[model samples]
Target: MGLNIKNETTHELVRRLAALTGQSQTSAVEDAVRRRLAELEQQQSADEEERRRRIRAVIRRAQQLPSTGRTTEEIMDELYDETGMPR
Candidate 1:
């Protein structure tokens, strides 16, 4: 099979690659482009899953909080008692 890709690419760089590795510009460019795309897809999938997990944790914490809230001073006193904070 043969690959034909036509776009703006550096001719001098292609010439140097052909001289060094005896492979055409199409082969080298195709391999490099495919690898880069694979890397991007993997990273994007991992990032999306992490974002979803963090959002779920935040939602769970919000759901556990009481609607009938204590005063700010009462909340601070409770926190201080729990942690043995200084007056």
Candidate 2:
């Protein structure tokens, strides 16, 4: 398989990487791609963890709120009026 790099800067970087690591151009490119993918995966995992933490905090706060003694039907009617829903 043949890989063609069109960007001059990218080509130069690949060439430098190959020389620095004592690897072929293809191996250097492959190693760079693999490292980038790993970094992206780590970042995504951290983002997911932060999202979960925020959700858990929201749930905890909601649980701490005082509960209204209204029945389900009464709550639904109140919400409908607040939203100006048609009868």
Clashing pairs in 1: none
Quantify all predictions' global Cα lDDT against the true fold.
Answer: 0.77, 0.92
The 10-residue segment with the lowest total lDDT in model 1: 3-12
Looking at candidate 1, what is the lDDT of residue 14? 61
Once fitted onto the true fold, the runs of candidate 1 whose alpha carbons sit more than 4 angstroms away are 1-9, 12-22, 68-87
Q: RMSD for all candidates, in order, please.
A: 10.5, 2.8
Scored against the true structure, residue 8 in model 2 reaches a CA lDDT of 100
Model 2: residues >4 Å from true position, as ranges? 81-87
lDDT of 2 by residue, 50-86 (tens): 9999999999999999888789889788678766694
lDDT of 1 by residue, 8-82 (tens): 466666667666777786776666678799999999999999999999999999999887577877878867875
